[model samples]
Target: MNAPFPIRKECPPGACVCNRQALLSDPQADIRILKLTREEESRLLARLETLSSLADLKKMESRLHEQLGIVLTITPSIHEVRTLRGISIQLQEQPGLCRKTKQAIPAAIRRSLEKSPDIAYAILDAHGLWDGT
Candidate 1:
């Protein structure tokens, strides 16, 4: 399957720690997926398993890193009013649900980091995110 969302090639989103270099200036762009219900999940899986490979998983996961929230470390133990802080607060308050992407990240991140200068590898451990690895 093709990527449901766009992956930045030039200025990647993880550029701060990676190598975006002001390449992607997506102000309001969102990486979205069709939230599949239980029935939808079963249906899609059946169709995908019939003719999909691991390459599809890898590509989709790679795109996810660029799709979701950008990497921004929140300064803990100190209250600082900043644009990053605003984003952090909003994320905590109104995070939405995502469907099963069946994609992985660690392998994808490592792959991208080793091969592409535009992609940076940063370790972020969170729930509700699929790292197909």
Candidate 2:
């Protein structure tokens, strides 16, 4: 039985399992790169530019620095705060489901970034927030 997906093998002791196809497809996956439209890229860039004050930029940088990873930058439905909060609580309880990596942070905090922060930040992005390069 060649399991292509990364499994902890100790989930809840009897957790219902699904997504065999996904595991078979992306077993041992490390990175998840996504392509974006020019407009999307520009919007993300514009948000970065809005970090005018050093304090704001520092906050952004700190958020990014503290990410568990698992990037989800292109999520369009992230503007929903309440939904994100629920997800956050779930994630906090299920820390074993996935490792916190640079990739996961963007996806997990999508709503928070879109609504409260209005700026996309990632711990893997770099040291500066408005590092417009």
How badly does each model clash, as a count of residue pairs?
7, 17
> TM-score, each model?
0.20, 0.24
Model 1 lDDT per residue over 37-122, tens place: 34544554444333233344344434433544422122212343232222121112112222112232222333443343222211
lDDT of model 2, residue 4:
36
Worst-scoring 10-residue span by lDDT in model 2: 88-97
Superposed Cα deviation of residue 116, candidate 1 (Å): 28
Please give, for residues 19-102, the per-residue lDDT of candidate 2 as tens digits: 323443665642221122234334544554455443564565554335322222232232343443322312222222233222
**TM-score, candidate number 2:** 0.24
| Best-performing candidate as measured by TM-score | 2
In model 1, where do residues sit more than 4 Å from their true spots?
1-34, 59-94, 98-133
